[model samples]
Structures are given as structure tokens and as C-alpha cells.
Target: FVNRNAFGHFGLSQDDFERGMNGFDMIAPEDRPRAIENSIRVMRGEKLGLNEYLALKRDGSTFPVIMHSTAKYLDGKPVGIRGIVIDITETKKLEAQLRQAHKMEAVGTLAGGIAHDFNNLLQAVQGYAELLLLKGREGDVGYRELQEISRAAKRGGELTRQLLMFSRKMESTLQPVDLNRVVEELRMLLERTIPKMIEIELRLTGNLHAVSADISQIEQVLMNLAVNARDAMPDGGKLTIETRNAIADEEVRRSQPELTPGNYVALAVADTGQGMDKTTLEHVFDPFFTTKEVGKGTGLGLAMVYGIVKNHRGYITCVSKPGEGTRFEIYLPAIAGTQATPPVDARETELRGGSETVLLVDDDDSVRALGAELLQMFGYSVISANDGESALQVYGETRGGIDLVILDLIMPGIGGTQCLERLLEMDPRVRVVVASGYSIGGQIERVAEIGARAFIHKPYDVDEMLMTVRGVLDQE
Candidate 1:
């Protein structure tokens, strides 16, 4: 005789349980033998406390449960076994989420370190290539080859940027953005990229709120999702991109603990194609985790998407069933009382150089050599230092004569931040340009706040570096 609670636990009606259904039948088929053996042992006087197993439900789905049992005795003889089964599905889900979070953290650290080193190497290759191109005419023997080398280095730099994005080490320029506009801009590209057989639909709210985000990163997110959807629908299906305004109230917070109650802009991508299983869904956002066969995919697409959303102070979720298709929803906080702004196009300007004495500091040997050469070739008197301590010494000797200080943030002793503080103390009017292989993030922002004259990202573009130097020197 099953209790009403037990019947409810398995999603069973009282009449169904009364039709000769037993406890063993409620346990999953694969776990039945072991469960039966454990029960027999309990009845035969073995004190097995609590065991975990998968409990089968009325619709053939299964959930994790923990069972505790003791042998029932009457007149010194065992009559039956009494037990309790408690569902632990939610507990198991929480545990899995925690483990995934830890794994992502560890991987992110490793990715950030690798990107830093890679950027330094690429800077050397690209910098020298640009220098060579400047000296040779277009038809000169190896001019085209040098151009190709520079382009290749740029592609390598882009890969590192993606790595930095996934590791959450890259900086973003956040602005008020409308999801509907983003979708519209990419509509033609998406249509051309995705197969002709697949149908595309856009369901945009007439008055969706604006989100504070990086427009380029949002475009990347949308493109990645679209490509993923196309791959899932090899036989052709419908892909829907939807944008809507939403509110994360108390009820919503119960499901997503990471979100605070506020207005949000929701962008959802849904596909009618083959879907993912529970196991695949769990690791979908993990770096280098891929379902595609070797050489078909890089596996960083979803991982980068995950990082971009998180970096923007947003959240994302995925839902899918084996053959029922998939859906991805991204929620970014709404910027109330704001309108989406179009990005301004930067006008092309002629690269110019100035006759100013510049002090260049970098620990990397190749980078230091290349930077000193580049600056001198551009008509600036260059002074070089391998570390922050040496940089301070050089600056002290040159004192007022040095017109600009190009300082590298990461150094062996007296790192960038400390060195910057010391330099400020020495001369409040000192002009310094902070340069690094890393993107403009927290540390860079802090340096700017502390009176950094300008900032430049490494793997230096000759024109950009020259332009930045010229721009800063032109300032009072």
C-alpha cells in the first residue's frame, strides 16, 4: 500500500497506484537490481543507511532521490522494510551549477595569461612588418609579402581578442543600444550567411527599452547564435530572433538569483531544429567544449558569448530537448530614460609625427627594440628602459627635457600602477602614455583616473601609436 505522498512524488493518481504498481517499479530499470539487493540486505539485518538512486516518474522521466530504509520487525522476525524517498533533483542541479562555475573560473585564468603573452609576440611581428612596408613601394620585391604578414598578424591579434573576451579580460565601450536596431542591421548578413532553406523571422517589440552595452559585442552574440542555429538545422527550419521589454520582479528572481529586480531588455533566439540533451546543455558555455566533429568548429563561440553577456552585467539561459528544438534568452539591464545612440564614424586622418623626446619602457626585449625603433623613425628622440625602476631613473636624468613617457604597465619590479603613482609624486605635470598588451579594463581605467595622459593597446599599430603619441603631445 503506497501512501498518498509517495503517489504524488511519482506523479501518479491513487487509482494508478492501486492497480498493482509496486515500489521497485517506481525505481529506474537500470537501478532496479541494485536497489532490490540493497533492500534484501536491509531486511536480512544489514544496516545500510541512506542510498541515492534515480527515481522513475509516471511520464517515464527520472529524478534523483535519496532513500533511507530500516527493516520492520514483528515478534523478533522481519516482516517488511520501511523506507523514505526524498527527491533531490534540485539539489543535484545546484551542485552541477557550482562545479561548472568553478571550472569556468579556472579556465578563464589560464586563457587570460595565454592571451597576454601571445599579444606581446604578435606586436613584434606586426610592428616590424609595418615598418618594412613603410620603407618599400607597393611593387617592391616583398612588399606584398610584408603586407600579407601584417594581415596575418592582425588575424592572430583578433584571435587573442576573442580569448581575452572569453576570459573577461577585455574592455568594452558600453553605450545605450537598442536590440531591435541591432537585429535589423544584421538582417541581410544573417540571411546571406545562413542557408537559403532556413527561414528567418524577427519579432521585435515596437517600444523596446535600451540596454547599456557594447554594440559590436552584441552583434557578435547575435551572429554566433545564428550560426549555431543554422548548424543545428541541417535539414532546414525556422530561426526566430525576438526582442522584448521585461521586468525581473520577485517571482523572476526566484528562478534567477543572479538578477536584481529591475527592468530588462530580453533578446531571444529560438530554432526549430535538432536540440541538445541535458549533458550537452550543461557544458554548452564551457570554453573548448564542442559537439561538432574535429575541424568543423572551434568551440569558443558559446564561451565568448557567455563572457560578453557577463561582462555587460547581464545573464543568459538555454533550454532544449532532444528533438524539440532549442532557445537561448539573454537579459541585459534596461537604461531607463535613455535613447539608443548611433555609433559615430571616425574620420580618417593623415598619420603625423612630432619632434618630441619620448621615453619608452617595456620588459619584452623584442617589443622594446621595435617600439624604440618605431618612435625614432617617426622623428621623436627615443629613450628606452627595460623595467619600471630603470624607467624612473631615466626619467629622473632627463627630467624636464623628456616631452613624453611611454610606460608599459606590466613590469618585473615596481609594476605599472606603483610606477605611475611614483611618477605623479615626482612631477604632477608629467605626461605619460600607458601601454599594455591587455585591453582597457579596471587597471587601465584606474590609471586614467590617476592622470594618465593617454592609453594604447599593444601589438602596436604604427599609425595608431604615432597618432596617439602625436595627439597627446599636442595637448597642453
Candidate 2:
């Protein structure tokens, strides 16, 4: 007879118990055949060490469990069977989390490697494009062509950024953010960006708790989802953005492997469009998996959303049917007593130049050369180092003359992070502008925490590079 605890584990009450309710009744329908086959082996005096399966509870929910069964023989022949059933729901969740983390890490390593090489190539293309632009007026021959090249290179840079974000390689500056405010702000944009045929609705909860996340990345997630929703409803349909405070109880947490038991803020994007089938939904968050025709999609939207949510320590899930519309719910952990800062306007800032000495450190010779040239053009005397060792040597020799160090993050010999540590040791006041082909996520954030003055992503334009240099140098 199953004990109270065992029955409770299956969400069954003792009053409903009956001998007719065999183990098969508790086993998931899809797994019943396998469970019976294993049990028969146990009955035959075979040692079934351990077996894993999905067991169905009284509420029609399924959970993972590990069972070990052995024959209870009275004589030489086996009479019956006894077993121990251990609940492995939490274990299964942890294992799933670990597997997802490992997968992201492996993919991130590959993305970082490719981005580094691609950024080097773009640097040369963009550098020449800018140089050509300076020689000719906007309407002059090859001037517009140069501008187009620069634009294309910038687009390529964005593609790499999306890839890095999908792999969770991009470093993010996390801060407390109000979910309601994000939705409200996005609604204004959605109203103009989406087609007139598509109706937008905002269902923001009042006094919603704040979540810890990057404001820009969170906006990116919302915009991607909104664009996806618009595309889904070609004929026009209703799109809804909703937010609310949420709490995950133990029972609820078991069903969502990515979520732990805690308070959370839920943001749901729903669309009354042609929803995805199970097959499409399964691969929706996979990079480069798109249902659109060629030239219509790159399929990085959902994948980037997944990576961003994971980096924010949040959980996201999609609900859809073939035609019942679709909804994506993202739950981010919430904290009390925190207020969100309004996002700064994205208008261009006035470019400035400074007369200071700069030590440019980069593993890539092309990037270093281009960076040094650009710095000199901005009125700064520039020195170059191809590696961290040489950069440190230069820093030690011209300690007072070097106003700032623009250090590349991924270099041969000592890595950019290690170099930062050594630099801080040598001069705690060393102002470093950490630069990389990669996004300002993982490694970049680490360096920032260790006292780096600023950050700039690779393939930076003349204006961007100059402004960052001027900004860091001008910092007192």
C-alpha cells in the first residue's frame, strides 16, 4: 500500500485511494508502457537498479521521479515487488538549468571568436569609408557610396551584437527597472511603428514591483516581441502588452524549470495572430530558426530575448496553438524599495576633442593602428601597444604623460581582464577605456566593476571613438 506521503506526492488524497489504482494509474500515459516493462523485470527477480520516469499526479500534472524496484520473494519464486520512489522534480529542474547554461557558454565561446575576427575586418572597411567621406562632400562622387558602405558595416556590427546577446556573451549594466514604465514607454513607440491594421493595447499593472535588468536590453526584448507580433498578424490583429506582480510557489515552480520559488514581475506580450504550431514553437527561441521566407527574417529575435532574460535571471515561456493566437510571458525576479531611472534620450551628443596623451592597446594590429590614427585626428598624442605586456611597459615608463589607456579586452598573452587587474595594482587611478569587439556584457562588466573608467565596443566610428576618449579623459 502506498503511504500518505507517497500518495501526497502524487497529489492524491487517502480517501480516494483504492487497490484498483495500480502504479500504471500514477504513471504518465506516454511513459506507462515503459514503467510496466521495467516492473515486469523486477517481478522476474531481475535487479532494476534505478529508473527515471514522468509520473502523473491527481491534478493531471506530471513530475520527474526516480524509482528503484526489487522482487519480494517468499520462496525460490518471486511473490511481489517493492520499490522506493524518490521525487526528482527539483533535481530535474537544476539539471535542466545546468544544461541550458552549458549550452549558452559553448555557443558564446564560438560567437565571441567569430565576432572578434569579423570586427577586425569591419574596422578596416569602416575606417576607409570614413576617410573617403572626409575627402569628398556628401553629394560628391563616391561620397554617398562611402556612406552606404559605412551603413552596411554598421548593420553587420549589429548582427554580431545580436549573436553575442543570444549567447549571453554581452555584458549588461543591471539596475532596478519598473515593468509598468517600460511597457508604457514601449506603447508609444508600438503605436507608431506597428501597422494601422494592428490594434495595440496596454494592460499595465499599477504599482508593479521593479525588476533588476538593463533598461536598453529590456527595451530591445519588448521591441523584438512587438515586431514579431506585427509580422505574425499580416492581416492585422490585436496586440496586448500586460504587466503584473507574480509569486512562484513550490507547486508552480516545479512546472517551470527555469524559475525558482520567489517573487517576480511578469510581462506578457500577446497577439491575436496566426499562432505557431508545436513544431515551430519548439524552435522559436533557437538562433536562425525563422518561419518567414528568405530575405524576410534572420530569426535572432526570440533567441536574443531568451538570452537577455537568462542574463537577467528571469524566465520566459511561450503559449500558442495553431490558430488560437500567441503569448510570451517573461518573469523577472522582483525586489522591494527600489525606483527606476528614466532612460536617457538617444539624440546624438556634440562631438568633442581633447589634447591628452593616449596609450592604445589592442591585439589586432589593424584595430590598434586605426584607433591610434583616429585618436591623433581628435588632437590626442597616441602611443600603440600590440599586447598587454607592452602596454604595461609603456604605462610604467610614461606614467605621467599617459592621460588614458584604451585597452582591448581579448589579447594574446595576458587577457584583457588580467591586464586590468595588473594595471589597477600598478596605478589604482589608471583611467582605462575598455574596448572590445564583443558587447558590453560579461567580461566588460567585470572590468567595469574593477574600476575601468568607460567602455566602447569595437568597429567604433571616428565620432564615437573620439567622444569616448574625450569623455574619459575629461572625467576628473
- Clashes per prediction? 1, 4
Model 1 TM-score (2 dp): 0.90
Residues 138-255, candidate 1, lDDT per residue (tens digit)? Answer: 8999999999999999988877877788888877778898889989989999999999999999999988899999999999999999999999999999999999999999878766
Candidate 2 CA-lDDT value = 0.84
Each prediction's whole-model lDDT (CA): 0.89, 0.84
The stretch of ten residues in a row with the least summed lDDT in candidate 1 is 436-445
State which candidate has the highest lDDT.
Answer: 1
Every model's TM-score: 0.90, 0.83
lDDT of 2 by residue, 166-265 (tens): 7777778888888788778778888899999999989999888888889999999999999999988999999999999999987768767668888999
